[model samples]
Target: MKRFPAAAALLAAVLLLAGCSASGSSNDAGSSVSNPGTGAVTGDGTTKDSGVVGAPQAGDAAGSVTSGSAAGSTSEVATGQRDVIMTGSMSITAKDPIKATQDAVTITEQAGGRIDSRTENPATENQQASATLTLRIPSGALDRTVTDLKKLGTVNFVSLNASDITQQTQDLDARITALKTSVDRLLTLMQQATTTTDLIAIEGTLSQRQADLESLQSQRNFLSDQVDFSTITLSLYSTGTVAPGAPGDFWTAIGAGWAALVGALGAALVGIGYALPWIALVGVLALIVILIVRMSRRKGKAA
Candidate 1:
């Protein structure tokens, strides 16, 4: 009976040990699954836990960060860019220079622009004048302004020009954006700066960035103003009166002859009038001499 009991206890102990071993094996597998650093799950039910920081969060969704940043940079560049140069010219014949200039000024104002300068002078005719005006017409209204200028008088000449500055404008805009980004980074560094030298250096960089930003802003503003307006040069010409002698070849010759004859007769009359005083003096002297000669001869004969 004692032997039987001892054998039964031994068998139970073996089974318990086996159960504990199996439980321990299951626990170890679960621990390995929980700690991905120690294990991995492959695509085919195989788990592999890499210790390389989860592939760095997939590097910003496979270029999402870079693409977004590039898109933002492009948008800023577009807004900060420069504009193209536009120019136009017009010439017309006007009867009155002042009125033409006045009309040009009105047109420029209506077109959202201004007159830069103006000049006027008398033409070949007695009352005719010519005028020239330099005006800045809004880019959108340049064509309309030119058309209005033409309507002021008889059209003589017209021209227009457009110049592209896409490359230069894009380059400037990129530089400005890059500088702004650098300034932002520098500011962040300044916030974390502990040493005095580092702080001072960051301050200097910030100041430089501010100045550069202001300069870029000024340049952009000027460029915008220029691009938004088109320059137009308005010139007025006058038609002179017809010269009398230039017309009617045969009649002109006849009239010229008549004028010459009249001129000769007037000259002869002026000459006779000028000699009258001298002629009178000569006659009085001759009469006195004759009387003296006759009296002297009679005295001599009586003697």
Candidate 2:
């Protein structure tokens, strides 16, 4: 009975040991499968953590950068200003064109403007005087100046035009900035170059960029000036009676008489020229008829 009990106890201990060994083997196989060739378990854990934490962080950084750039562009577009050029033409009838022209010049000067050009024709015996003026006025005071000028004479014609150059100006500004940056970079490169070939190449590029920048700047300045000042083409003509005793009245009268005489003589000559062909045809027919009648009489006498 004692041996039997001892054997049974040994059998139980063996079974328990076998079960523990199987469990350990299964765990080892699973660990090998999870981490294939890597030896460090800690490293695997660290890699897992970093992937979980770093992926969202990188995505967020990229998204933030993109959104910031978008916001900056939106703000720039929202704040972009427009450049406008204004021009006008006006025709006025006045009693005296010279006086009206002077008044227009004075008004332009008073409005912080200037006359770009002016022409006046004095009154003659038969024709009224006229004047044409090109004026530059402040854009802000264009309406007021035009109104004041209208008071000088009757408004025969008027035209106003406006052009928006915002896009053009913005494009020029961007080009200028880019060209300047290119020039600066080229200059820096030229300074750092050790070889003559490199220096010459960089210098050539730099000079081209600088010239482009200057041209863009000039265009921008011209656009800015057009925006600042408005142009006005004003024409004035006499509406009242012509003065008979003007300085050139005698010469004008003589010219008029000579023109009328020449016109009459030309008309008479044209009439004569048109009739000559018809007159020649009639004379030839008459001569033929006379010859035919004489030939008939001679034939009758011979018979």
Candidate 3:
């Protein structure tokens, strides 16, 4: 009876040990399979957190975020850079200075621009007349404006220049905004400016800043105008021509030449006639001086 009880107890202990061993082996095998030869173990026996060597670091969530932001910043800078300033000029020859200038003005207006100034001279001899015009046109229309201007006359000179002024424009804008803020602040503090000395100092500083603001505004307007318009110079000249006479032309030419000579002589005499008073005054002064000296000499001889 004692041997039987001891044998039964041994059998129960062996079964319990076998069951525990089987459960432990099953859990370890599952972990190894999930890791797929990487020797990694996770609480859930899942391979989501484990990766092969050099596997792109699981798609880089934080790095991707930074890269996106940097790309957006670079794109903004490039776009701002594109807002630059460009200049263009053209020279044309026309048959009439006034007509050419008028035509140019019309064209400038049609191109959504205005003429800053126009200079035309018709009284100048040699039939060489010219007009210079400063115009403001949109940058997009610069090329078309030049083409249209060229149609007005023979193109003598054409030039174009482009410069990056984005930085300058931005800086000026910022400065203007700051000056405006300062002006507003000063106005608010006007009641506090009691003492004469303080008042003078404040006024002086305000005046300076106001002047600067005006200057900056003027510059901005000028730049804006330039960006919108192109400058053009037009010159006009007439070709001189002579008419031929019939067979007895030599005699006729001689007679005409003689008449011209007589007329020129008459003009010269008339011009000299207008100068007679000044000429007489100079002569009288000289004679009086000479007579005074001679009379002094005569008086000395008599003594």
Candidate 4:
């Protein structure tokens, strides 16, 4: 009877010990999972979880970090508000380039636009007067502005380029919104950060999210500016001045060939003019040498 009782007590102790060991292991696993800063966000804006971290814990407010510029692909812009950027270039020959440039500036300013840059070269002895003006005209008034500019001079060449960026705009807006949400969540977690390690981890993530948000905001602003303001590059020159890159016809080809022939003749004349002095000097030197040799031979024959 004594041996039976002792054996029962020993078996009960062993069972309790096993249960305690199991419980300790479970607690250890839970604590390890609760720790942060295992896998951080990579440079390309992807999240990598390190160790066995799962979703937001019981008291934690942050759920998961979202990537920058990778959110919301299905978003759409409003109808009729599609973002389109317009850029155009034109070449014109006018009676006067300076006056045309001034008129162009006035037209752009009147249409609620401005000049981005202007370059003017007064007619020199060797070159005709020319002006180049880069104007930013409001998108709504671009067509009218172009028409008005055409009146300033005779249009030689004109071209317009348009790019539709509505999808890109919507995508950027969505990314900004997502980044904002992520930052807000991180902020909340930062406030609740209980350990130094957790605080550091949250701070790093918050910084990254904030940086991404700012960058996206800047991009959105630039894109909006491009959509609102259409760019036009106007080139003006004197009426008699040849427009650069105007297509050539048969007559033009003949004129170019004639000019090339004239230029070659002129170059040959200049080269001959340079060589004439050297040729005279060599002829004079040869004549003196021949006279001295003849005189020496006569003296030898007489002796």
lDDT of each: 0.60, 0.65, 0.54, 0.66
Candidate 3 matches the true fold with a TM-score of 0.54
Model 1 agreement with the true structure over 1-303: per-residue lDDT tens digits = 655554443333333323433343243324221122211111100110111113223333223323443444456557974357898788898767678788889888988899888998755423456788889988888877788888888898898898876544544444444445445544555565555555565576457556766786788677777788888888887656453334357787688778889999999999999999999999999999999999999999999
Q: Write the per-residue lDDT of candidate 2 for residues 1-303, one digit (tens) a residue.
A: 755554443333333323433343244323321122121221212221222213224334333323443333345567864578999899999988899999999999999998889998998766789999999999989999999999998999899999987656655554444345435534544454555554554455456556656876998899988898899999998887746764457887798779889999999999999999999999999999999999999999999
Query: Candidate 3: which stretches are off by over 4 Å?
Result: 1-77, 80-85, 95-98, 121-130, 180-215, 236-260, 275-292
How big is the positional error of residue 69 in model 3, measured in Å on the Cα after superposition? Answer: 19
lDDT of 3 by residue, 1-303 (tens): 755554443333233323433343354323221122221111111111122122223234223322443333346567764445666677676666578788888887898877777777663423355667777767778778778888886777887778766545544444444445445534433334434544454455456557767986898787766655545443443223222332247887789779879999999999999999999999999999999999999999999
Please say which candidate is ahead in TM-score: 2 or 3. 2
TM-score of 4: 0.57
Per-residue lDDT of 242 in model 3: 29
Which residue pairs in candidate 4 have backbone atoms (N, alpha carbon, C) closer than 3 angstroms, thus clashing?
none
- TM-score of every prediction relative to native: 0.52, 0.57, 0.54, 0.57
Across residues 160-261, which tens digit of lDDT does each residue of candidate 4 receive? Answer: 999998776765654455456546645655564445555566566567557767887999999999999999999998977555544358887788779889
In the order shown, the candidates' Cα RMSDs to the true structure are 30.6, 26.3, 27.9, 15.7
Shift in Å, residue 100, candidate 3: 4.0
